[model samples]
Target: MGGNGKFHKWKIFYRPSPSKSDETHRREPPPKEFICPICECLMFDPVVVSSGETFDRLCVRVCRDLNFTPSLSDGSIPDFSTVIPNLAFKSTIVNWCSKSSAAPPQPPDYSSVERIVRGLMSRQGGAEEGKSRIRCTEMELIDAVAEMPDVNLSHAVTELAHRVNHFYSSSSEESVVMTTNPPTPLPLATRPACLSLSSASTSDEILNPNPNSEDEEFVAKFNSHDVYEQEQGVVALRKITRSDEHCRISLCTPRLLSALKPLLISRYVAVQANAVAVLVNLSLEKTNKIKIVRSGIVPPLIDVLKGGFSESQEHAAGALFSLSLEDDNKTVIGVLGALPPLLHSLRSESERTRQDSALALYHLSHILTNRLKLVKLGAIPTLLVMLQSGDLAGRVLLVLWNLANCAEGRSAMLDQNAVEVLVGMLRRNEFDSESIRENCVAALYALGHGSLRFKGLAKEAGAIEVLKEVEKGGSERAREKARRILLMLRGREDGEEGDRDGILELGGLSRTRHRVGGGVGKNATIANSTEF
Candidate 1:
């Protein structure tokens, strides 16, 4: 009975064998959506373009760099103007890879993709040349005419002139017979000949003349495979856009921006530096600011800030500062992680980079979200260090004033012992510009208003003595803020509610809230008063 039970268990656990066809069959390839339209490789970083087509980010960048547009299977051209990440498609590709037990796709090397694009461009060029060869050919049909004897040509010309005169005379007589010979005008026959010649000249000009030929040539050089040519292209663009406002507006097209995008992060120092400098020029026009940001150029600018050549980093910081002047770009710049690098750049050995980075931070920190981000990134400590070192003191103070407007910033400032730094600067009269002194006082005022801890920190730093001096000798704006800060600090000392009530009832620092140098409110004092 035991043997029979064991046999029964074996029979119950038995399974069917696999067929030969099943073993021989292979896994299917990944779906087409996984492939980049430009590189024809499995996409790792898929981004959707304006035309609603998905492509690898690197692939799109290469296309923009080369100024090459590939035709899709449906014969549509993908718009390379703007691109945003396609997170849903990327997640799908990952899932598909996992289920198939296949290695996930990785971004193809940029050079390899570039080579592929160049090849496609070459092939397309050859085909287009073949189709337009006859039309574009410069054959000299006049040579045959020139070869004829002079006598025969003269005779032919005379014969044609005789027939034209006869036709004109006949028409003129008819006109004379019909009307009372109204002042004899140029013959109708001559009119056709003249009109034909004028139309021919106009058509020739329209077909052959190009006013922007120089700019177009420069733009074409950027698409060259040679790095030197690319460098020359960027240098020429920089020069043209620097002084010519018209060129700045005209060259700020989507196509040119697309071509200039990749070179902004070029590995070559000259190329990257000049490319970013050109971007700075392009961004000088107010209209180009938002367009440049929309072209997805900010990320490369940020990358330049983080790791580019020193010269390129300076231009990158300047470019960011230029872009930040536009209110629409402030949130975008901060959101794309520019705050930390800009903060980090404050300590750079290059003075221009430090100043530009500081100014950029000042403008960007005006946004509430950006102020919070700066605080979270520990900017207060760095700014305090730079402030005490007297590197870009006025600009650094402006950034601190903006930070003082936010609650998180105020807390961060208190935590970083900012009160002592400002008080010490005031007591020592370290600033050269009265505006900087005023900014210092305004920042302290903001800190006092936002956080109660400011009272304790200021008292420890002997802020009362510094405020008295500022009240006595500083500008009217500085004196007012100084008195208000003194009242807040003095209120803390007297332990009297009326002291607090008087501080508030003194119009709640009404003079500080008045517009200073066209400033709208208390917060605008630093932004408007200091000209970084």
Candidate 2:
């Protein structure tokens, strides 16, 4: 995804605490005010309430008030309460814990189980375990305590959370710890109620309300008329794109892609084609990059391109284009024969699809320079077919320019006799349309750029004459690309070693070679052309 898919940088950060010497300036200045847990000053900022296990004491207090029991760590509340006083809860709890030295946790039985049992465990074991916890026949004593009057189990639950959160908030200083990953602030109501057993309404939490159900509903109801329309014609080749993203996403069992292979060719073309493009882009995303690429999904994309798709071929072509540039991606695309359909798309009626197709070819042509299987795969014929089409002058020019710009097709250019077709397009009789003139000049430039040897050949083949005509017409892009070709051919006439100086040393020669709308008399005339 990075430029040329070669070199990329990832940023990482390390936070080193300031040393003691610099602590005066860097350390968090001591809390400007007491961040009391009861007051909920800094909202779940550690309160440092008597640390070890104060919740056990609160549980005892509730049990005492309920006149029920602690369902103690080992015994009922009454029995556990007798061992510790209400005032000395902390010391008693610690001493009792120390004396008991809680037994190490028991491990689950891992002796060999039947294959069927293992499968059951894998599938339904979690549900079974939850059932066991809630309805165990052996825990009669535990259930009886749930009936406790003063307990108000909901209040106790809220109180316990409040006390725990309150205790922790008071534990840490009230300084803003500026970090990309500082702990998220607890909800105001939850934080305060969590500390000291308060029941205040949560302003932040209550206001935001249900986030998902409403979002899902809104997303469902949102207008998809636009999505449906967008997926029509050339864009409709991406129908499966809107099918999953905008319209069908609202369906009960919506899918971004399908596993049940489409039944009809039309279905496959509509859904699979867009899916191919979607999968390609998703493969570029940071979140989906690893999963998508590793899943080996590209083979199907390559298949679609290779097999061909008249309705949605561009999607596959574009995807294949991108995949060819990526590491390990070209293997499948190459095998599935990605080049043919992409070439077809360049001659497509839809300009958008053709552009994407051409762009992919250009990208493929510019890579590593050793992937000549693309060039040998009849890329020249397909490129010329698109280039020779009268309707595609602009697009054809771009394709030719890119082809001639790179080293990938240099050898193929000479071997395939591409120069003659390109030179054939460099006609000067009809230079009235800026587009035709520009395309003519571009084709010449592409031919001239192949090599020093080709540059002279291209000039002799009338590339230089077309350049003079286009420049005479004042087409800026044509003039620039054309001027470069003229300078390159002049340098080529001289030996490659002697004076390689080309565009840079054109100051004196420009008066004769570039006279805009007029000829420079005999000075710039070629051998066969009369100096009229």
Candidate 3:
């Protein structure tokens, strides 16, 4: 937005005055100067959609930001990719607005509440607008509507809310509406009530439409809604969640969560991706995290992980990553069967998917209960495959390091030949970050505490040479761990047998294969002192 002074003058000049002329009064023509369909004002930075309608670039950009698809006549929608700059119109509007500063003020055509909300919900144009602009516009329009006292205003709000809801559902309407041209406006009585807020029930109840065929006609309508709206609607929800604390608090209601639950399982790819994105942001607040878990989103999210577009998988994994930070969520996610798909994601072609999944795994592994669960679920082999692939080395190493804390995990690793991989990584010495080497050393140290089979496996793989090299030049922590591993290996070679079952203690926490009595059991106390 520019200086309001010039813009205010421009607005006054462009809008028609009541007493300008008899000819203008008798048969008024729509403004020859193109008015923005969005703000209903003279276009400054004029741009045109493929439909031949021109609007302020900023207004059109707001549409793009919302992911709303612009509807056109003839039952067709223009591909945003075809939107172009109106260079000639831009020159004209700029000159007109510049000269209008000297013209007299006239009453502007205030857009109706319905129009304002519709514009907010309309498909986004091709150009991207700033988040600040979108937020400001949303706040101004919502505030304006809220200030109105007319009963019709409430009716309009209810109508608009329903329309917006229909715009997001996973129903059949989306497909039909998207393929057809924009339809003629229906009489008020004929309009569907997809998001109607009834006086008989609370907003939360209205928000919770039936998951299995909402006990109403509109829920079926929801099942048959347009695809474009479904995509943009969730995108808008994602934006709202990240807008500000006030907005986030308002948007993260039980009603809203109920609404979003079906979207996680939506047939629409963008809908699923954006829904996961919103969940990821919502889970940042502790209260929201609890609410999200309770909403039973984990199972559907795992479904997305198992089979979704690469981008959606990333978002689902990211959401899980955020949720995994809470202890309660860890058990719930494990019980709900989120691990297998997560393991599957580690094998995805998309680096971001792998990264997000690995991060989620790392966080979940922090919970002592999840470590054994992960190991038993065949995490060791999957992790070994990831390690051999050479991507996510640091992340994988840290997760492996955590898993190696217990005997079952260590034995699983030994069975998976993790010693060879750890020694191989140490032998490379080409790492840019010392953390990678440190994790490798920590894991090796954990393996070294296993039975004689483990130590022989390491020594057989030339661990002594790599340990000496790392001890000489690695980070101080790596150096210390490497030295300890070398000493342990050499001591064993020298016929010294000292606590072979216990892992080497790193600093305060003894780093060994296992704690004295801490083994993998339902009540096992896996030490909480381990740090990556």
Candidate 4:
């Protein structure tokens, strides 16, 4: 579905002939050395008749046995005594077979579908399942289904969705509940607030496997095992992801997500994590955000973020971050108490977990209400530590900038000595990107707006010289900001003129755009030089 005409580099097999009119000349077929005269398939156990015609040994033997006189290519009877095995042809067949076997296995075709069906049946009760039990995982089966032709795959998805819908509707609540493990109570601080929230809730034509009977039977068997069902659900989700945008939107139904939520309580960490990962991927499409959030995925996801394994926590944080992009979901996540775990993740050993946590905080802190909660949870000190050493310095700085927007946040930053850290970042040549410097200077400006003590703190941390250099040579946005901070430090405004050594409004400026994360569309304007 995503095909584009950019495959010229992959056109390695053919070079178009310069003579376009050469279509009049037909190309000859390949040499017969690779073909067999009788039984037509690629030569295997080939024998050369006395007439020097090559035929499959089994075909010749069958013909000879079926008739008293088997006519050869020369129309002469061949004596069984004269027919010796064609050693060279046999050797060629052996070599061909060897090479074929050594090559990597191609993607599954019709036969693979048959194998997958057999595996499913064997899981129910089939002899072949034992023989090939180790061959394909549930994930591999889902991948193979997704790789089917577009029409067949879409049909498969639709059929599977219908079956899931049926199972959900027909099965009693008690039955479904019995299939899942009892939910473990989350910690008081991390427990989901939405626990009782009433949330509104592949392939092939013969390469087309039988969807109803096999899928139904397999799902019925899968229902008895929580881990297996979670695996199946995860694979189904992964298959949807491999499809096109339209397909993803179509398959990510509320019923499907509702069916998956119970799997979060499974004893298997892999299952819980995979379910959250699927939700994260599905939530990337903005239209799906409300459906997922309303599906009651938020509570379980927050629970996973709170205490699941590191991988699961990372995905949960990412999901929350993306969901928070929709304005309504920000309060939903924040009220559920997502801040503590997200803050804890900032100190996690896994870099991915740390970054996802920071990103979530970056979004959460954008809310004025959230900033107060975050500062209370000690976000300022944690962010300062991360700003100094974490990989998400730019993100950390942006969050700090957001917090610096209000009086309470400004108080928190002042308490955390944020000015010293931000100034230190400005002073390091290696630490300065346009975003980093701009945020640093703006933050310093915010922190130093009215507090002489902070102004002194910044100067002690080498901010004045950095501001002078920024005013002279940094981006225009940074320069203007530096001009403002310098003016604040010098106790003057744009109209005030000064001597050569004193701060002055620099002119002939190079204009440039500067945007801090999460504050892009809002004012690029800093708070008043007297707000603090």
Candidate 5:
């Protein structure tokens, strides 16, 4: 990224050997060190690497280029060790010793397969040797393993896919482990960690060990069966970087994301939010989102949003909002305990953050889905306080508009005097006259559709007077809208009486309110109903 990302003709390099006939063909100086020969940089401590061929980052271009190769003639094994040599170490040392640097050899265009393979085989870590070096993050290591000879990167990735409950299983593991790559050999304590790979199934002794009450002879036999893994010196929770972009990793072998979880549960706000955002990015897939929501992470996630700084809060809020959109995650936050943090974000200093929070709350309150949750979580009052801020008015209205999409939302809107506040706004033209007014009216219409309560409140609050005046000389759209509202009101001014006896019902209501929905129907006794 630092050097010019320009492409050069393929100056293919051939290994020079003494046996070649010089008369028939002269050997060149290793093709003029094609493709930079080597980046004069430090190797990852105890490790050295080089790309036998060069390919651009994006995998699409390689296919078009005839030079790129996706598979070997056999496609049976990887040819990295054969086709590509780790020659960068020697070349880099040579370049550094003699400062007379020449332009790196330009290589031929990469073929499609080459591009894809190169992309799949991304090279990381050409670090300076002196300074503290970083450990490859779980992803970096995974990418390395994926690119290795004979191993199918895609297949390796799929081995831990969500289909086999891998997502849930992984989430349930140590968070620290989840955060990094895999288990690394830490300094072996007196009672060091013994590792084993239970890729498919485990032995009887490991899967279900006998209780202490079991016969000692039987238990002793099982104890001898414990598997010990290859132990090598490894840094857990080490920084993962390519000398420029850096990430952190916990271990090297078994699983990432699950490894650094312990560190993530730090008391520091930045630490918590950082951990959550990293996980959030990694959990971009649907299964990941679903698994996290179900894993008991909502509380910690909420805490980060509620207690962290503006940026951290924003990150947490964004993560929760993302989870709110997924079908599997929609109800999980509320059920799993993410409500409070979401409400907290509404009052945040950042506008984008507040908007996202409001949007999440809006979705949560869709009809009867999480409307009760909204009320129970005390979202209404927070939503109201937010409306007081000029910056929040637009988003507040947007949320209201979407919430109105559901039947229970409409009912709650009318029951909570949501009608009263909205009517007051319309009566005095409190919001912006164009788009704001349109959105407000739209919200009112949705609420009124479920029950005549909204219509009655609007009339009594003198909203009708304002609507009538606006309709008198207003645009055709405004006039048509007011006329319809009037119809819904059925000329009633008091909510005690309605034109029709339609019941817009939800399960959770006050004991006195009628229960008219399926699922967890409880008391809908929340007097602050409309507020949240």
Candidate 6:
């Protein structure tokens, strides 16, 4: 069986070449679905725009930057308002490349895509008219593209193209067309208020008299039977909320929230991602955080966290993290059962998802009820595994710090052999951040409040030796925590009945109780006050 296993490995490593016919078949061009609409090449990072069209991410960015839209074969203009990573499609392309023994596509160069867009724009007018038409200087065009943001560039390009087309359609005999200087760009604070695209407008000019009119339009589009309109509404809202805090405040009404709720779970990747991202933006406003939580948005956000598109899951985790920052939303979020899914997200393939999940769990664990729930949900073992794996060690340690604050949490940590893992990291100097090391010692200090089992565990894990070193060379916080933990460990090892005073001392309690000879008097108070 061992020889057969080795033979199979060898066969996989050294396969024979295919015949001419098979080679010819394997070398066929990638399918149309894999080809980017703008560059007409196999997409390296295919992303879905709000129009439900897939294009390379770079192509989309370049087109948006140049203020030129690709004219698709179907003669439809894609909505470039939002772009969401089509991860499943990208994965399929990768698998096809592997099976066919074909090289995977690389990202198209920016200059190359820019050149293609320029060619398309030039073709918008007749070839003869191109030579006769007065054009903006190349340097001026470069300066305009450099100074403008994506939205401004789109509007500027559209306006420029409109002027050129109008100029050519006229029968005026004058040859020299004096180009007026472009208007000075508005400050960023005023930019979002003036965004007026052909399909969408974010100017709050009508918001005062008819507040719900704009929101009503978006909600109508959001609830439409047409998926493209739904995508356009959500994407526009996403962009608007991201740019203007006022829009975030105004658009977070219950009616808009209700309209957005279903799209959070939409089957379309672009809609789902942008919808959740819009929620994240809404949650950023301090006043909107609790409003969003109370609007029954937490459940769908949790659903997205569980099984939505990968990009949407990242935004969902971010939204939860943002919401969890509010004191009132913390317990409510935990009650909505965000803990398990959030704990699962700590292992997500996306680093942003993992980071946000860890932070959300950390904030939620601040409440005593939530901490106990986390212990019940088996978070200690999962976190310990992630910590040992050295993924997001600093952020993971922050969550562990919160988990270590409760009795059930401390007990769970000891049972999961957390001491060995933490001490192993400290002894090896595994982390470069002093804050991470301090957090490690702080977690150990919190666990020191446990029963004699912690002492045995600490001794077995060689924690005392490591703590002493931390005391000598670590930060002031690390040294202080290490000092207290060392005192507790020695006090326990000394076997003195009054050593409970030493434990109380580690809890920052007065040693006046030393003469009391037992920990019965203020043990509960000490335990409660000393939680990290």
lDDT of each: 0.65, 0.37, 0.55, 0.53, 0.41, 0.66
Q: Write the per-residue lDDT of candidate 6 for residues 284-323, one digit (tens) a residue.
A: 6667777787556676678788887787798898788877
Off by over 4 Å in 6: 1-214, 492-532
Q: Can you give the lDDT of residue 363 in candidate 2? A: 45
Q: Give per-model TM-scores.
A: 0.56, 0.39, 0.51, 0.51, 0.42, 0.54
Candidate 6 versus the native: TM-score? 0.54
- What's the C-alpha lDDT at position 116 in model 5? 36
Q: Which candidate leads the pack in lDDT?
A: 6
lDDT of 4 by residue, 279-317 (tens): 665665557776676555666676677666555676677
lDDT (Cα) of model 5? 0.41
lDDT of 2 by residue, 1-532 (tens): 5788688797889999777567545544323222211121221112111111122333323323433321223321112212122233333433443454422212212232123233433454455434322211112322222211232212111111122222211101121111122122111000111012222222222122122222232222122233222122212222222223222222211122222111111222332343344443333222332233333344344445444344235455544443444434433343334456667666666544565566555545443332366566666776676556654454444445545555656556656667666666666343324544555555455555537668656756676676677567645665765666677777743222211122112111121232223345444321111000
Structural RMSD, model 6: 23.9
Error of 3 at 67 (Å): 37
Two-way lDDT contest, 3 vs 6, winner: 6
* TM-score of predicted structure 2: 0.39
* Residue 354 in model 4: lDDT: 69
- Top candidate (TM-score): 1
Model 3 weakest 10-residue run by lDDT: 184-193
How displaced is residue 443 in candidate 1, in Å? 0.6
Distance from true position, residue 45, model 3, in Å?
A: 67
